[model samples]
Target: MDETTTAGPAPATTVGPAPVGPAPAGTAPVGPAPAGTAVAAESGGWLELLADDCSPGDIQRLRAALLAGADDATRRRVESEAQLAETIRARLADRGRDARELRVRDDLVRRLASLRDSAGLLQEVVAQSRFLLGVDVAYIMLPTADGGRLRIDIVDGSLGDTLQGVVLRDGEGLGGEVMRSGRPLWSESYLDDGRLRRVRSVDSIAVSEHLGGILGVPLRFGRSTLGVLLAADRRPRRFSDHEVELLAGLAAHAAVALRNAQLFEENQRAVADLRQSNEALKRTDELRRRAGELREQLTAEVLRGGGIPEVGRAVARAVGLPVQVLGADGARLDAGPGTDDIDVVAVTGSAPERWLSGQEPASRTAIGRDHLAVVPIRMRDGCAGCLVAVSDVRIGDETVRLLEIGAMTAALVVATERSVAEAELRTRGAFVTALLAGDGDDAELRRRAVAADIDIDAIGVVVVLDNAGQDERAVAAAATRIAAELHGWVAQHADRFVVLARQHDVASVRARIAALGDGDLPAAGGIAPAAGGVAAVRTAHEAARQTAAVLLALKLPGAVATAAEVGPYRSLFSHAGRDDIAAFVEAALGPVLAYDRARGRDLATTLEAFLGQSQHHARTCEQLCIHPNTLYQRLERIGELLGTGWREPGRTLQLQLALHLRGLAQTLAPDVGRRGNTP
Candidate 1:
């Protein structure tokens, strides 16, 4: 039969020559059979089968015909031509498919732009994707908050309801694989595919939906996979690369939509929060202004000499709290009205002194139903006191700050009062000094003393402190304390504090001075016997000066010696460096001194104490706090050193005179007789 009359469709004209005309009926075929006649005939039949869209059985029959009697060149030529035809067909098919895809993409873009909300846009997108992809089911599986799995959030197409809320674990099945790999994945027969991890929940859902194949594409934004977009078929199907790319494009649009929706919602909440914060700030500013006015009013009251009482009342009225002012000595200076329930004493006693020392104001919870806020009143000296504000209602920070300002005002008042009192004391002290120094007339001195609230005519002892090594201000402070105790006059005499106290109160004055003790200095004081009138003041002062001199010259610290205590030493020290006194001290203490030097003993000190006690062994031992036997032994040693004539009547008189002179000489001149040699 002719080529046109063949049973199958005809092959392309470019493939080869048509079938030979029956080999010219008898003789040879035409002209060497056209290079490859037999192979061309076989190849032509195969091409015919390709053009007919034949079933596999028809294509198999055509394969047998092409192979029969075909040389290697024919086989190669057939393969090359077949590949060329396939390429041409694929290019033509792509051109047609691209036109269709362009149309679908335009429709998707138009639908997405027209939809006002993310939910509508996403639903429409999945619906269009399912229709375009020709799948049984199409859905979006977006990541949950924790990003460990994906849940179906949008669905469309046949059997879509079954996957409405289906969740896929990470790395499980096709959808999980796409999300984890951030790429597209497809399975022709999902249940039979061993490449993907199988999950019971995913498998059960697929079985129920009659799904045999699936294609999944990761929904990506930048480098992050937002979720997976999936297309599935009921019958087994091999998904095309083109179909995966289309779904991935749709997923990218969906990610942008979701992110936009989230941003719009977040901005809306931020605007609402900002408005609320603005309203609260306005309220706070108003409170601050009101607090400022309260502080101004309290300050005005203080400036008008309202004192601590007025301050307390102002604070109580402004803050609606009970207020109390405590002095440095813990005395309650003022308490506001209705402060009966507030325990001023307990609060002041319990106030933290450390806080006051550090100058840090603090508030604390108090007993009963009250709250206590303490603001310390500080001055140049130290903490003057604290203002304690008590309230049944809780006090806010602004109110506490206002109370601190009030405390500062009270401290100013206290500091001013102290300054005035100190100035007055200085003036009185100057007048008393002039009177004691005998610089002015006696009558004039007495008159000035009376003017300064001092009684010069009263009988009183004159006490003098010498070489106290204290600054004038410290001395003044100590003198002020002592004068307050004695109700007497205290003056700065040279470098000493001189006091003229009442005769009956002299013992109390001495006790007070002794109690004052030696603070940061070695103070020596001397008290004269009580005498009357301004004429006797000079004599008593001279006696006090002499006694103080003796105390200092002897290196005796904190010693308050009187006229009676010094006895003969007063007369001996008065005539310092006299020949008769030196000779007598040499005769009496010479042997004891020599023995002490040779033996490295304190025999001279023992002998002096023994003789000072008038040879009373028990009193001397008691004074020394030593055993009587020890004293007796020392005395025996002294007698041995002195040839046993030291305790006789005439000898004792000489010895007593010498001991008195030696003590006086040492006090007068410290270097005399210091080398174990008599002066």
Candidate 2:
């Protein structure tokens, strides 16, 4: 309340506590007792005065006399009794206050739910603040448009009219301070308080109103303070801690209720405007009848758990035109019955979204003596899709409006479906994550799998996908899609995306995963055969992740393979000596040698020439004294026989090094190079 204007000099005010004043007239031991009065009270003479229900003054005098003459033990007993009595009184008072506060909060919640508009809610909050505290005035200060000042929005109590619509400038009053600090502040004799900065215009109003005691609490909604809820008194009175608490609680409730009511009003206004526009556009009886029928059918479909298919049919029937529902990605979700004749070429080629650039809710394009219109299906998440309508002639505004109604219905159904799908996905993801992490005992794992409707025993393959510079959301999306397709679940244990699939063929599973990208793996993956219980699953998950890392380390970014496929090379990086190197080279070269021996082919010589010639077909051909065509055919045959993985740079490097070892062995030891297939 900014009422600081005063015409004359203000009355002197006591700032903190009640001022000391002359004592009230009373019988202060008018007649003096005998000299032994203080001493005689020790034996029980003073106690008899209490049996007569003595006056307050007489009891005070008697009590003082006993305490003055009492020994140390007696004084201690008296003090303890006084302390216990004070504690009891405080506790009882607290109980009453707590009960009152609970009742007020409950009432506020109920009132908020019942409030239909912002003004009514604000008015109720202010009134409750004043009545609950029995203060002289209560009001809320809301920030102005420019936010440089606050205006008194609503007030209650007889003194409130003086404050309504008063503008409080920045740094002028306690209201602004409370708002800025987001904490409650109170002052006795606010007009005379020296600690607070005062503006002449606001202070003058305070003086004129004779406002004294004031308390302000920030009206907070979420992290922001919308305004200040303040209570002021006409007398220089000190507000208690309990009173401050009560006002603050009310302010919190008011903030939430005000915001809710604001949103509600905005929605109501929008709906009303839409309804009015619809009525104005209602031109003929037949059209009105059809629109009404469409509304009912669409509403019933949504209410009865319908989806795009149901919604599409109703709109098509009402408009006597074909309708198609497209998903967010422009994929066909569903088409109405007899919608085979829809202009697929026109609709697919045209961007329906571009047509929505103007003020119209929907737009259309000509289709060779026919028309196709689309209304965007806006759901809570975003634009979920569009409703495409085809007509024998140009589309009309009324038909477009009907399509919008259908779009709205379709959005609701799609949103509900999406929500359910998302919830299921979360449940599945969590289950798979727990399963992979071995979070629970065997029984618990089985129970979780059963609840998620998953068959634990059907699982045969575990694959881990590498993020490896992929968008996290995109990686997750791919994992979820593949997991669903495979009748399994995806879990992200740290950065690796693990998919537990039902298929047992690791190679076939890798093939499916490869299709997710263009012709290679969507992500570098490690595939392992899954079996056993928690321990086996955990071991396989670790192995799969290890394999994926090895693939990445080998510079095979878009490849999926098992750990054993690269185990020999992996050993080359570990604690392996000459024997290990010899064994690896033989292992790497033996396949080609054996195939050549069996088929009488030159695959081994071709691979040796290719590697020795730095994989140049012309150079290898010239070195081998063969034609380029022959070199190519031999290289292809070598690739098939050895499965060399020559395209991978790391694999090629390993083969090159192994070829060097073979050459050295031929020079140093005559029989070493002939161990697999002799010349």
Worst 10 residues of 2 by lDDT: 1-10
Q: Write the per-residue lDDT of candidate 2 for residues 1-679, one digit (tens) a residue.
A: 1111211112222111121211133424445544444443655454354334333334334545556667999877754543443344334434555666577679878988799888889888988887678787888999999988899988876443557778876556898888778899999989888887777777767777778999999989999888999999999878878678878888988888888888899999999999988877666565778778888898888888777899998988887788888765455678558877775556446555453343345466566666778788886546777888877778987788888888888878877876776687677667877776567888999899889777777778888888465666556666776787677777665555778788888778777777765556557778888884666776776667667666665667678787677554433223344467778778877777678678887676677677766788788877889888887777777777667566477877877777765554443242122222111
TM-score against truth, every candidate: 0.43, 0.39
Candidate 2 local distance difference test against the native:
0.70
Local accuracy of candidate 1 as per-residue lDDT tens digits, 1-679: 6322432232221111122211122222222332233443555844454454432324323333454688999767655654454444334444555666778777777666555565676688778777777777788888877888888888886454677777878887788888888888888988889999988877887888888888888767778787788888888988666667777777777677656665666777799999889977886796677667777886688678677788778877766677777765455677567666667646545645545656444555455566678778888877877777776676677677777767877887777766765676666667856765566887788788877777877747887766645545545555555566567777765566777776555566566678765332246777786677776876776677667767776677558877666655555434353556777777777878888888899888888788788889999999889999999899999889888667788987877767766766766553232222122
RMSD of each: 17.0, 28.4
lDDT of 2 at 678: 16
Misplaced by over 4 Å in model 1 are 1-306, 309-313, 326-351, 359-372, 380-382, 390-394, 450-679
Clashes of each: 0, 10
